[model samples]
Target: MLKKLSGLSGIAIIAILSLQTNAFAQNIVIPVETQHNALVLQTNKSNNLNIVYVGPTLTDKKEYEEVAAQYRQTDEYTGVSNAAYATTGSRSLFEPALTVTHADGNNSLDLQYVRHEAKKIDDNVSLLTVDLKDPIYNFEVRLFYKTYFKEDVTEQWSEIKHAEKGSVVLQKFASAGLYLKADNFWLRQYHGDWAKEMQPEESKLTHGIKTLDSKLGTRADLFQPPVFMVSLNKPATEDEGTVLYGSLEWSGNFRIDLELDNQDNLRVIAGINNHASPYTLQPGEVFTTPAFLSVLSFHGKGEASRKLQSWARNYKLLDGKGSRLTLLNNWEATYFDFNETKLKALLKDTKALGVDLFLLDDGWFANKYPRNNDGAGLGDWQENKAKLPNGIASLVSEAQANDVKFGIWVEPEMVNPKSELYEKHPDWVVKQPNRQEYYFRNQLVLDLSNPQVQEFVYNTVDNLFTKNPRLAYIKWDCNAVIYNAYSSHLKNQSHFYIQYVQGLYSVLQKLRKKYPTVPMMLCSGGGGRVDYAALQYFTEFWPSDNTDPLERIFMQWEYSYFYPAVSSSNHVTDWGKQPIKYRTDVAMMGKLGFDIVVSKLDAKDLQFCQEAIKTYNNIKPIIWQGNQYRLQDPAGNAVAAVLYLNEEKTSGVIFNYLVNNRYAAGSERPIRLKGLDPQKRYQLKELNLYPGTISSINSNKTYTGEFLMTVGYNPDVKAGRASVVLALNVIMENS
Candidate 1:
């Protein structure tokens, strides 16, 4: 097989120089080459199988470049338990290497392990099994990876054979093990920005992607389909004797930031997964294992994050005894430059409306008055004594005197180049040293990977919380997307990803430890970091800053799949200005809050706010703790619906929206309710408060099998006017 493949390609720079057979009729071959241009293998010569490397390499290394590792002495961090589940024990730890061998048998395939390195710290060497193996490869050759780990990640997790083509380079980032993927390189080529320069990548129209007016795409450009993945998994538990895989390769390089994404955290849990590799291990043949890990994890970044997830999972927010947050939002009152007197006036009027929370939004601390720009005032997490007179403390006192809780918004992840902190510690920001600094929203990301930065942030948050434990709520904001894939705290540009995420986690963790009881609100501008991972600690997720209700109606609907409605804090937006894009009702389904200044609320909007709050108060419990089912996809359909139930199974609420061009007239849509008693018949109540009413439909019926229930539908009105409201309750025996 080696001879046949070697003869076919005259530029066979690398071929297994030797073959060894041990216990079985197996053949093991280790090929040596400066760079891997292409990997082609004939498994059996008879066209039975062929292995090829057509993608990027380990370093994402470009051609004619040296992808070298400054190999450090193998040392363990500390104890055996510190080995995260991946490490077996210290005794077997050895040098970085690869093992390739084939178990010679009539029906045997080849197995390959590249760049295996394991060791123990403090005099212990742990034996490691490089987990890189693509047991089944009926699919095409493709390498897909994502940086998904939360804290701890290692190089072994994402090591795959590097790929190279001509002068351009491509690298594998399977740091996180295996994606549920089944696509081809040809498929990826058509849509990929990386491969367009060559061969039309995989052929399209005669004219390929023109770079004449070359412009790079946004972060989402990296997520095209046709991704190649090795479906890898592990034993269900520790005792299952699972081994981690290792791989190596060399290829193309480019600049990219993976960003502070938390979606993949749950996948890289350093434990067993249900989708382990599902094929036998053969020797000698090069097999690619793709994964994502904290491969570029920075260690010197002493900063760490604590989440309210497991620790405060059981905590429930308490209502204030004196009054609810009659909040005065600087955004609605005056977007950027509101002074103490302006806020004071707004507070006085809001107090009359029963607002208890006096929360300030952006533009309070910078000299620009309102956010004249992003970079100027953000790095300074201090009071703009100029506008905030007497600082936030005085306002806290003032609010306290008025019997209102004081809360402030802080976007800790950002640093404005024009702010004091940025000026003081210019090295603190992540840039290419001399390269053009990439700015997003006029901000630069701080290198939280450093302990000094961590302490600085800790001190800032601590001073505020400790000085005033009375701070009831905090809106933690992240206003910018990161760019310039470089980190001063890290050894190189590759390490930026792991370090930035570590920094975010560190700050959040410290905040949780200090203010365990405070209801921390998560707002990534809004909806950016709004996911289950953030919710594990954050009590509320501000859906977005754009409060156009027409937009919120569709937006909040899409937000429901992964998030509970009560945690989605959406305020009523201008129904008159942007009615098509503003939706007060769907937005109110979340933890209902106000965004506009109460002093500006007209008679009708104020009444609507009151009515919305009341409705929220009634259905709040069900939305908070109820089991949720996505009846309609707000993203796809004209509208969406949710069914909520109390634990007792005695009562439940069914809120449905006929959000569509109901003009095709009205048609009944079937909804199958879950978690109901089969034996009991429940009486239905339609909330008359809603504009439309369900004249009649399936009422009290025993749910025997998977019962089907149909809802009486109404025809279309305008775009967002149609709604269906009903409440289902299981009738009690005596009642």
Candidate 2:
């Protein structure tokens, strides 16, 4: 009943069935259009669709179909490796594409493929639907792949519709099952902890299954960031090499599995966490999974990353208003000890340091219980009258009088057991009916799954904004992940994870609509919720609580691959013994901010800080909105460098950091920059006034972009720790 398609290679055509010359050939060739390239799926002799080519442009060449039908055949029929609706009892033993639990408790989905259809939903979007049905149970599923031609990304998810006389439960369903060649394929993932997030890890793909998942009910947990990439075993440099990457646009528990089959075919399965998740569907009911965005790049990992970054900035993330503001957060300056006078003094120093926004983080709320510590007053949103008798309005007024914007911090999704809100709505927290609640960080997560609870959270934030009309920004922090995951109102307890995220999304959407102008940031104690889904709601993300520039070089390098610089809020913290210029240089690469005590620095250090802030403000437009390139791998080398170039290639900046490592041999290496118009000549110079503290280049000179990229710029890094910032301007265009 099935033909075996064989002879598939890296860009090789698979032949399953011999087709006679006919007009129907056009129907067999499926072409998906995207912003950067086209993905062509051609049906072979097996009557199944397989990817033939994914490249720069769409082609209707007849030879593509002919070659697809001309490949060698096999005797055994194990079904196609790239099964659109791979089900139970199939030849494949990896994760099933669809698992349907019948009313009789039998778990099997025997689907027979019917046909495939395509539709142009919009000028910039195309939709492909593959139809499959179970012959015995009358269950049907439409696997969908939507492509945004301008975003250079494809999204996949499935919609299941049941016509069975009885009910069925959808146990496991993957948003996409991408099949790729297994020859020398490598998997790259980002792993780290609370302070050190987005650390890149790479390994070669071997036999068996390798999975990356987040089950802590948070998307970007301490162990894993919500992204996976695969490239050739020998990856090319930043500008060249073929790579493929995918990410789930969900903030809740999710899983991504990569399995290499016996025939050396790699299958990537990604969707919601199905470990304990099961959705029951009654007769005439339907279920749909969240989309999994997948991108392919023939050029290199950098190109693939740029595609995702462009899509995120242009469509997903909040639109920017020119350059970002240099903010000064008071958390590090005075932790819970500041009053009106102290804060006023800090504001004057912040204004003197060229800070445009003043953010007052945690410990400013609560009247019944002091929020001086994390153990009390989390759910309380009122300003502490004892700490600030003049109230938050006066603080906002003070900031405005100093010509700086004002912002406040809040953790609306969590509650302390000692708070008034928790005492009144004890049942609102996430906990089982009979089990004792286990608190994380002395705080219990509010059950946003409940609609009434969501309304309360919304009102709390809305009232805060209503009370303080001058509040221009909000630091929305979620310090703890959901544990003891149980919702009292939901009977299907397994759906708690899914419903909790939905409720959180509802609250965020409501707040975004109510306060369109005020930008809110996403922070999960630091970098836990920094995913594409969260970016749609928040304007920027705090990369980490650890502001050590040495650690940040690797963190920002991996983080910027999928996200633009504007999405990251980097702060210069006063880590003991670290130089101020080194910290300032690291933070200036992204959305620069100061998390140190501005009033405590000496006159010399303060002058350096003032000059650094001015330099960042002058070049922030290129840093925030430009194409970034990791010039050197910070993890592998002691000398790390990163370059940012604007769209026009007229201006750019490069930051070089030399770490103090015993493994470092004190060898000087040429740092080649990328993302430049090779025909143009550029002039590079160090931005700082401090002599010999930070070296810009081996030779202070001008060179063509081609020579800079090919010949390279070597920075004079001493044996000790040091950092330098280079400002580049276009001098001439050879073209």
Candidate 3:
């Protein structure tokens, strides 16, 4: 019998029950659904679980059952097409999600359906766990699925347990495996290096395996973030096709494999990369993989991104719904050469610009091995008496006097060879027993895998907050990559990569619990540590070190496809020769900040910056909590535009940037806006317009949202005047 619980806002809550069978073959079906999406799993007569469907919600249970029945395999070759968690050495031949060598020397695994359970965590979320066991060995695997009803997102992970007397070698353990059947598949991936991060690359899937992975154990996201999107039957677009997207919640070495089988089914397996790191599970021991979050959208990549952003803000990120403070960092301003007097002057400038927070970046620490440059004083956390005679408390007091908050930067996970900390604990760093040590930025990675190192890292933050209780923010940086990859504390060095991430997470979790409200920014040379697992503890992330405005336009555009703009710290720096207004306009797309020396700004530039800050404060709500639409792609056109529409579709903002004018002959075409209420009228106004710049559209005109969305307005941009930001508000009528 099918029973229904009381629903919430038209969302049906179906009771989980197994259908009875009179014959020998038993059939089971489990439907995990949110408001907008559904993931249905079914078991065939052989007791093998398979994913029957994963797409928009199928409200009719009978319809989905019929769909599942139609997919019953009659041939052995196609049996693995819809496998829920394919394993090695079964009848399957695909890339297995779980691979283990048993203690008795058997390498093959055949998992059978044992039982399952489903429960609601709250009104907005539900969890489902399916238990599977090997018919021969004493090995078991439990797959978990957590669905967010309102956000239309599903999170999946796996737990493996062994009951054998000896130990089992686990080679591959994927968090989640998804199977989709489509006529054609197009994969969109984000990849880049150092300052050039989050660059999007799209490719069509053929009959082979496509792998995206990271071997940089510590700064995993330096080359690529553990996230991707796949469009069905067509090239990916912002708002027009069926798209599936997912992201891994691990900050260590991870891998994503997209394999297109001969049966025209695309299988996606994602989890921690087991490259040269095979874990051993003892008797009664359980190993759990990190969560893999995913969403399926019928309306296209735009809808998928909006759902993910909503989930991240409402559930995953720390204080994600709150607005970020507009900060000014001193890295580009003074570099590593500032004292109490210079810093207090910078605080006055910060107050003059109306910035909320002032960050004292590097160079404020160490006495014997001062951080005068990037080559020293990384792990040492004590304030340099020579640089600031009164310590960090004096700066905090000065910032309070100027009505601005104080923040400081620290690279706690790195140690310079010239520092006292490394000399004190030589074995605390990650290095092979006798091999040569490789250095990056003249520093080595601290072994977070060791408990002593974890304690030291935690105390570094505790001491800062204890000494200066009014410290408003912290910029935690990791400048060194894992080069030696060896941990002396562990009996098996193969566990170094996984244990190091766990150790880092342990330290962050403690800090988050201690200082529940302090905002922290995660930076790893640049966007290297921008994964969800780390974001849970930090408030925002520095997207890149290169603060060039033109480069940021394209970089932030690609970043917005997955992450929310509110958590991205974009700064206006002196890296490029672009105009002050142009630089400010680009940085305004995300959490606004300034990295240049404000004291050196000319009179006109200073006035423009202060006014621009005021304007950003007025429209930040729309940028932070709204649906983003890529009106134009920078890769395909000379001019790129982006629009943000509030939840109610009442007010919005649009920013357009001119990349180059050499091939911009037809760049004056009016771009059709998106996500607007057709019945209302909007008044448009230009903001932060450069002096003497010609307006592309009539800024004083009022147009119906229907007309604005269909016909649109031209963004006439030229080389001299490179960018424009327009604000739109509802034109209220006399009701």
Candidate 4:
């Protein structure tokens, strides 16, 4: 019923035509297209689908034939090895794409392709659905492939529907699977912990099973980063080799397995981790898995990342396109010692530093529950009248008068045992009945899976917005993990592990619908819930609580590969912990902000703050909306650098850092610039003009982009924890 499958031989065409009209042999082929590439798929007689081509666009039948022939030469299989929607018998040897248990007491499954349909949702979007039937169990699996027109990425997900005749148990189901031709491909993944998140690691794929999975019931950074990449041979640079990448779109427990066979066939599967507990589905009940997105790039790791970033900019992030407000948060300045007078003084200092926003973090709410620190007052959202007698109205008005917006922090997903809310509804916390509950930071996670609890959370937060009409922002914080995990509402305890994340999404969706314009930031004790799923609801993410610049250089580098700079809430903080200028330089690579005791700054430090803000504002456009290039990798390196180029490639900013290495002579490596017009002449200016900061460059001068990128520019040596910020602007176009 859709446009003809495009390309096939005489026998293949006859086979396809015969199946299209017959109910028993109906098959479909789906073609997904991006701006520069096309992914063509074909369904065989058994309804099994194969990835025909993931590289260049197939315009004609001849090109498609050649691609298919080339594919068959490598991966010689009737099916795709692990086809979509279709299921293979146990004797097939490879992992079953969809394993199901029948009501007849047998767990083996063999699915036959039935019917399919195609829908063109938009000019840049298309949807393909293929139906496969498990003849023995009378069940169906609907495979979906959603492709974006602008991004070279396709999202794959599926739904399992059963008939009313029998009950079935789904043993294992993959959201997406692909078999690729392998030749010494290098597999890359990210691993880390709380303050240290997204540590990139790689290894060569051998002839065996290699898997990266998380069974902690939470998508913690310590387990995995929810994304993986595979490149050819050695580590691919920003602009050279072929790279294939994939990312899971769920925030809960997930798994990604890369299984390579003896024939050099690499089969990759990614979806929600089953945790060895199979889901039982009754007649007419359906189960759906989270979406898994795949992308192929021929230009290298840098270009592959840029494609993902393009997708994030168009679909994931909020509608804002300008530079984020430079905020000065009052956490380190005055934690828990909340008073009207001290906050007012800090507000005055914030205004003097040209900060665009003021965030009154923590200790602003829960007076009746006595929330002073991590020990109390989490779930209670009532304002603390004792702390601020006049309420937040005065503070909001003061910030407005100073040309700043006001925001507050709230941890709605957690509750302190000492709070009134927790006392009123003791069963609201997540815990197994009659068992001792575990507490982290003196708090327990709220059982969001309960419908009544979801409503209570929505209304309480909705009421806060209804009262405070001028509240511009909210810092949504999740301080602890879900321990003693059990929900009383569900009879099956295992469902709590999945439904909890879904319930959280429901609450966030309702809030986003109610307050669409107000931007909210996502933070999980800092860097715990940094994934694509959470990014869909929040504008920015707090990657870590650690403000150490040396450590953040590595964290920020890992975060930038899949996310834009504007989505990172980086800050300048704690000069005593690190050099003030160096911290400012590190924060400038992201959505720049400040977190410090402003009143403690001397005249010289105050001047440095003002100068730093001025310079950042001048180059904020490129830093916010630009292509990033990692000049030097930050793998225990003494020197690391990152550069940002505007869309037109005319102007950019470069941040070069000198890590904890004092031996400056050997560390002076020439830095090569990227993502610039080679024919354009550019003027470079050094931006480290603070009191204690000094530049390594010999001079501030002009050079062609070609000379800068190829010939390279050297940094001045002699440093003990230092940094350099350079602003480049196009001076002349090529004649």
TM-scores, each model vs. reference: 0.57, 0.90, 0.95, 0.91
lDDT of 4 by residue, 513-596 (tens): 988767778787777777777788888889888778888898898888778888899988883366787888899888888998
**Model 1 compared with the native: what TM-score?**
0.57
What's model 3's lDDT at 48? 80
Ranking by lDDT: 3, 2, 4, 1
Best by TM-score: 3
Where does candidate 2 clash, by residue pair?
A: 16-45, 17-45, 35-149, 241-300
Cα lDDT listed for each candidate? 0.43, 0.77, 0.86, 0.76
Question: Which residue runs of candidate 1 sit more than 4 Å off their true CA positions?
Answer: 1-328, 348-356, 367-375, 531-533, 575-582, 635-639, 661-675, 686-721
Least well predicted 10-residue stretch by lDDT in candidate 3: 11-20
Candidate No. with top lDDT: 3
Query: What lDDT tens digits, residue by residue, belong to model 3 across residues 1-735?
Result: 222323211211111112123113556788889998878898876678899887778768757776755653435464555789989887888898889898887899877787899999999999999998775566889999999999899999999997866999999989999988778899999888888988888989998799989888897888888988999999758888999988899989999999988767799999999987899889898899999999888887888888988898899888889978999999888888899999999999999998999999989998899989988888888999999999999999999999999998988998998999989998998988798978998999999999999999999999999999999999999977888789988998878899999999999999988998899999999888888889999889888987888888888887777789888999989878788988999999989999988889888899889989999999999998888988988888888899988999998999988887585444578888898999999888888865555566686688898998999877666676588889988988862
